[model samples]
Target chain A: MPIIEVRNLSKTFVTKDATVQALKEINFEVEEGDIYGIIGMSGAGKSTLVRCLNYLEVPTQGTVIVEGHDLSKLSGAELRSLRSSIGMIFQGFNLLMQSKVIDNVMFPLLIHKVTKAEAKKKAEQLLDTVGLSDKAQAYPAQLSGGQRQRVAIARALAMDPKILLCDEATSALDPQTTQSILQLLKKINRETGITIVIITHQMSVVREICHNVAIVQSGEIVERGLVEDIFTHPQSRAAKQLVIEGKDPDEFAKEQEAKSKAVPILHESRKIRIVFGTQSSFEPVIANMILTVGVPVNILRASTMDVGGTARGDMILGLPADPASQEKIISYLKERGLAVEEVQ
Target chain B: MTANEINMILTGVWQTVYMTLVSTLFGYVLGLPWGIALTVTAKEGLHPNKVVYRILDIAANIMRSVPFLIMLILVMPLTMLIVGKTYGSTATVVPLVISAAPLIARMVESSLNEVDHGVIEAAQSVGATNFQIVTRVLIGEARVSLVSGATITIGTVLGYSAMAGTIGGGGLGDIAIRYGYYRYQADILWTTVILLVLLVQLFQAIGTLISVRMDKRHI
Candidate 1:
């Protein structure tokens, strides 16, 4: 069974003047030991969706089943115990400014009624795991942003939780720091077998560590699949936008303009964009089709680059101005397992 | 100065210190919990209750609005009932605590409120109960601010204690009134003023020292 299951989850924020629907009937399941990324732009309810998984933000409708326990039905004491088993970290780090790093790490253990000496020993071990054993006596204000996040991670692991929710955990750090933090999270997951749910607006973050991804837009999951699948074959407009924008802003703009112009002349000839995965880029499929089929083809634009260790290419092809020829070309590409989409 | 006058001034100093410290202790004993309730019941608090917050908020405001001197007179009957008399250092403590408690409560509320909501959420994420969040997270985090607030409360109560002298309350203020204002002893009046200033400085210095020692943010 999936370790975490969310069914038809929806959340609406009601105020005096108006009500805002932050999430809408979101449904997804996370298996054990999966690094799942909920990717979205700001205000896309990505944070809210993750918060619901841990019952931080209760869903307005539907049920959240974490390890087969319905979150909404659990009593306060039961919910608290459940929360202790599921750790969470945040972008702000949120370390107690008044406490030393060691004490901050010990906070969760102490809350679980662990003895002071035992909690302290465990905290020191965890701090050593995060490579901050020497800085245990220092306050959070004295540490760098990266170091503060390390302390937060240590604190989150104090309870030996089965799952960890990361809400923009690296958003406040520099690129180098973000890379290091991602590495630490990956290491922790590998060693502990902890399932991680990452909520972030940065597609690069998802590409760096996520095994699977769900693209959320306007309070709904628009597209979801394995990271490689979504990266190479984005089906929804939102997912395509994220993929293209993640690759290159300049190329995305050019592709968008070509696709808009393609729509007006759809009756004559259809402009098609074919996304080539790393393996297929070496094949001379396009050249072969033109040579064998005796159909004239025009290439408007093309670019290929390595993304997440895989070579991918985006090409805009102009076909002969005939419905019969367009149909044949599209089928031919599809038969070869290339992801082809009409530009318009 | 004569030896007799020096003895009187020393006694007055002790009385002033005793009244100030006693009133402040009692004030906080009552106000600290009151303030926590106010903060926790607030609209944006852990367990928001508009009705409880509104009632407490209004009560605190009403108590605070009353001028200290007028309140001292208004609560004379209650003061008599509590202390069995109404015109000495002990009697003055009753009104001083009554007045300072509300002020201290408001100070405590503001101090606890200054604690970051993100920190509170962090505590909650770790399965901290509501009481744990309040005692350990809210109060523990706000300790520095609370200490500073207590310092200010003590200073204000010291000033109120001086005002108590108008109703035969004992302290340096009473001696200043009797020897300087009534008898026109300018030297005695000046000495009392200087002593009050020195007391305030002493309390301030100690308060700052303690607050800084308690703070872990800088070190």
Candidate 2:
């Protein structure tokens, strides 16, 4: 069975002035040892969903079953016990600023009533695993952002949790630091067989480490599948935008608006997007298609990306007005094993 | 100053320090838990309870609203019951604590509130119980702020201990009233004023030093 199963979960936040629906019937499952990612734009309710997975923010409706226990049915003590088994790290790297690094890592073990000596030994080991054993005496404030996150990760792992929840855990760091943290998480998952659920807005994060992904859009799961599939063949508008944009979705939207205004006829013409996997990444398929079809295609946009360590290339081409030429171009691309779909 | 006058001044300093320190200690005994309750019941706090919070809120407000001199006289009977008298430095502690506790409570509440909510959330995510969150996470993280607030509380309590002089509560203020105001001794009055100012400055400097040393966020 999947280690974490979220079945039709919904959460509503009722304030004095207004009731906001933060999550809407979200459903997904993380198998044991899977590096699952939940990706979305800001305010897409991914954070709320991760919190509900651990029962930090109790679901307003439906149930969350983790390791065969329904979180909603558990008592307070039971829930806390379950939470101890589910490790969590946040974007802020919420280490106790007053505590030393070793103490911060030992926090959860101490909370669970482990003896000081044992907790210290375990915290040191975890810090070693994250490659910060030498800096154990330093305070979190004295460390760089990456080092702080490493301390947080060590603290989260102090309980030997089965599942690790990362809520935008690398968002606060620079790109290089984000990469290092992601690598550390990947290493921990590989060595320990710990199931990790990553919640992030950065597509690069999902592409780098996540095995399977769910795209959240406005309190709902718009699409979910293998990371490679979502990146190469995004089914929903949100997924396509996230995959194609790759960085700063809102900025891309604004750029798209500007492009439409600059070239109004570009949208009016028939456009088709073609995706090619690693096998065809080297071949000039688009060029070959134009030469065979004897028609010049207006290349709207083209980019290549590494999806799941394999090079995949995709491009949007404006087809000729003549239906015969369009059909020939589509078939030519299809014959070469390219996934083609008309862009609306 | 004569030997007798200097001796009187020394006693006055001892009385003032004793009343201030003792009152602050007693004040925290009542105020710390009260402040923790206030913070834990606040709207954004760990365990928010409207009823408990409202009661504590109103009580603190009422206690703080009453001026120290009026409260000193108003609680005179209660003071007699606790310390068996309503005069002298020891007796002044009762009213000094009574006045300082609620003010300390307010300060404690605000200091605890200044702790990052994200840290509290992190504690919760790690399965920390509410009590653990308060004592370990909230209290531990807000130590610097709490220490600084205590310094301010001690300073305020010292000032209030002086106000207790109006009711024959012993301290420098009593000497100032009796020797300077009543007997028109300018030299004695100026001496007491200078000592009080120095004591306040000493308290302020110590508090800053402790807070700065305790603060790991900056270093």
Candidate 3:
């Protein structure tokens, strides 16, 4: 059985002025040890959907079955116990600012009624796993943002949870720090075989650590599959936009506008935009095609990036004015498994 | 000042301290729970109950709106019933506590509210019960702020204790009214006023020291 099966889950938040549907008919299943990513812009209900897995925000409809137990049918005590097995971290690194690092890690263990000595011992071990054993005596405010998040991770792992939920866990940190935290999360997943779920607006984050991904848009899952499939062939408009932008949409639009005025228009030639997945992007397919078919290709606008530790590129190639040569080049690219689309 | 007069002033200081400290303690006894209830019953709270929150919120507002002096006179009957008499330093505590409790409750409620909702959610995610969240997360996280609020409450209660003197409640205020205003002893009036100011400063200093020691944010 899948470790977590969410079926037709929906959530709506009601305020005095209006009722907002935060999640609508969301359906997904998490396998035993998959690093699942829920990717979306802000307000896409990614956080709400993750929270509903642990019942932090109760679903408005449908059921969540974890480990053969329907979460909606469980009693309060059963839910609490289930939650203990499902650990979650936050974007803000919500460590108890008042407590020492050790004590913060000890929080869940203490809540679970573990003896203080045993809790302390277990907390120390978890802190060691996160590589923060020396800073156990320090308060959260005394540490940097990255260190605080490490502490939060330690605290989350204190219960030896079966699943770990990360709600934008590295969003607050700088790029360098985000890389290190993602590495740490990946390491934990590899060593422990714990199922991990990451909710984020940053596609780069999902690309870095997630194996499977679901693209959420306005309270619905628009697309979901292997990270490689989504990155290589984004089927939906939202997924395509995410693949193109690779960051916040607003900022990307602003950046594109700033560069737009300075760039010259394309000349009179056939333009083909090809999206190369990790495997195809690295191979000398373009060079081999040019050498064999003898079609001179002009690169108009090309950008290559690493998505999920694999090289992928969105390249717009200017083909020769001859219709025969353009057709030959398109056929060659398609035969090699590259997703090709004609541009104006 | 003569030695005899200085001893009288010292006695007045003792009485003022006694009334302020005792009343502040009792005030918290009632107000802490009142504040917790206010926080937990509100719309955004852990266990929101509209009717309970509305009633308690309105009651706190009404109690706060009444000036301390007016409240003292208004609660005289209940004060007398509680303490057998409504004059002197010990008896004055009855009315002083009643006035300070509502103010303390409001302060406590605001302090608890300042605790981050994220922290509370973190606790809940770890399978913490509502009681555990309230006691360990809400109260634990807000401890520094609670202490800071308590300091302000202590200072305000000291001022209210002096107001008790107008109704024959013993303290520096009683001495100031009888020995300075009535008898035209300007020296006695100034002496009591200075003593009151010094007492407020002392309480403030001590409260700040304790709050600083308890604060883990800076260190």
TM-score of chain A of each: 0.83, 0.93, 0.90
Task: Candidate 3: list runs displaced more than 4 Å.
Answer: A253-283, A300-316, A341-344
Give a tens-digit lDDT track for model 1, residues B96-193.
Answer: 99999999999999999999988998898889999999988998899999999999999999999989988878888988898888989888888888
Give Cα-based local distance difference scores for all models.
0.89, 0.91, 0.89
**In model 1 chain B, where is the ten-residue run with the lowest total lDDT?**
B1-10
- C-alpha displacement of A11 in model 1, angstroms? 1.2
Candidate 1, residues A1-344, lDDT tens digits: the string is: 88899999999999999999999999999998999999887888999999898887889999999988999999999999999989999999999999899999999998889999999999999999999999999999899999999999999999999999999999899999999999999999899999999998887788888889998989999999898888777889877777755743334557878977775643645788788876676789899777766797888878774454466787879888888888888888888788887765
Once model 1 is optimally superposed onto the true structure by TM-score, how far is the C-alpha of residue A48 displaced, in angstroms?
A: 1.8
Candidate 1 ranges with C-alpha deviation above 4 Å: A247-274, A281-336, A342-344
Please write out the lDDT profile of model 2 over residues B1-219, one tens digit for every residue: 789999999999999999999999999999999999999998888888999999999999999999999999989999999999999999999888989889989999999998998888888988999999988988889999999999999899889887777778998999889889999999999999999999999999999999999899978
Tell how far residue A188 is off in model 3, in angstroms.
Answer: 0.8
Native contacts recovered by model 3: 0.89
The most accurate candidate by lDDT is 2
Tens digit of per-residue lDDT, candidate 3, span B48-126: 9999999888888898889988988898898889888878898889888888888988998999999999999999999
DockQ for model 2 equals 0.87
Each model's DockQ score: 0.69, 0.87, 0.87
TM-score list, all predictions: 0.90, 0.96, 0.94
How many clashes would you count in candidate 1? 0
Top DockQ hit: 3
